[model samples]
Target: KLKDAHCAILVVKMKRTLIMFSFILLQLLLGNSLSPKHSSPKPNAEVTVMGFVYCDVCSNNSFTRHSYFMSGVEVRIVCRFKAASSRTNEMITFSANRTTNEFGLYKVAITSLDCADVDSLASSCQAKILSTTRNEKLVDRL
Candidate 1:
């Protein structure tokens, strides 16, 4: 009788362990399936193009110790992206105007579904200075 009770206790423990393992496995599967999918950027994702406007005090076409960042400078950003697939000859152009902040930083946030990544923007994007609050004229260095 003692041997039978020992075997029955072992069987109960085994059943409990199996039930716990199955419950854990089910929870893991459900967690993975219920999670949100974000393999790529959303349709309304915002891409920011930011840069700083600085004056080349030395006029050697490079930033030096005498150079300073200029504030309240108007910058125009233009980005052209080709269609993802070559089947369509569609060229999407995004243009925006932004003014430099106190830190001489200008930012243009573009919300578009056409822009896939920043790599595309780096190849075909251009930024030009439209105007500045200062008396000096601004030139495109990059």
Candidate 2:
């Protein structure tokens, strides 16, 4: 009879422990749901510009032995607004400067946040390719 009583007590304790653990887990989940660390940006969010330089057949014609010409190229990837807005401008202001690799490929990345700093110089905004120096000859984009 004593052994049976002890087993019952153990079972009760186990149930209480499980209930407490579940309560703590529920609290944690609820807390996180209430306050997210990084809320998603609104639709038609601010522009994030990324510039990539690549060498392609500059000529309109198809690839040929002599047609494999290389030239420094620059491109802009605009983040356009999804919906039209009266207050919003047609295009966001963004610019980046970068030099191409030996194979003629370079890239730059800028965010709308960067534009807030009026004192920020143009050189500061440019994405520097630290690995490749002016002397270094790169075969492809890194």
Candidate 3:
């Protein structure tokens, strides 16, 4: 009879733990859903964007002609998607701004949450040179 009572007590404790855990989980879900930044997004898949920043030490019109691979430059990656609505097109965009690594490379990882309506398409995303960390001196021919 004592053994049976102990087993019954154990079962009750286990049930209470499970119920409490579930309630906490539900509350977290509700809290997340209430926030605009924490929108619903499927997990397990991610998008990584990477690039390098270089300085044209010499005056050059070609991309590969740049002399120096500049570091410490701030880069931004913007992903956008457009859909037609009524008469105008609606745009959805996500942006990640980060500085470059030691190798002058910048990486931006966009999860489904980061990309609201955008996809991992070449046309849907873009990167532009914002500004350099420091101003460079110019030389004039005498």
lDDT for position 142 in model 3: 8
lDDT tens digits, residues 1-142, model 3? 9999999999999999999999999999998888679556556445677777665566563345445566777777887765323454667677888777786788887665433334424477777666676665211110
| Model 2 residue 61 lDDT score | 35
Q: Give the per-residue lDDT digits (tens) of candidate 1, residues 7-65.
A: 99999999999999999999999999999976985557567778888887677777778
What shift in Å separates residue 137 of candidate 3 from its native position after superposition?
A: 10
Output the number of the lDDT-best candidate: 1
If scored against the real structure, what TM-score would every candidate get? 0.62, 0.34, 0.49
Candidate 2 vs candidate 3: the TM-score winner is: 3
TM-score of 3: 0.49
**Tens digits of lDDT, candidate 2, 2-75:** 99999999999999999999999999999898885897765432333333333233443344343332335333
Q: Every model's Cα RMSD, please?
A: 4.7, 10.5, 11.3
What's model 2's overall lDDT? Answer: 0.45
Clashes of each: 0, 0, 0
Which should have the higher lDDT, number 1 or number 3? 1
Of the two candidates 1 and 2, the one with more favorable TM-score, higher being better, is 1
lDDT of each: 0.77, 0.45, 0.65
User: Local error of candidate 2 at 124, Å?
Assistant: 28
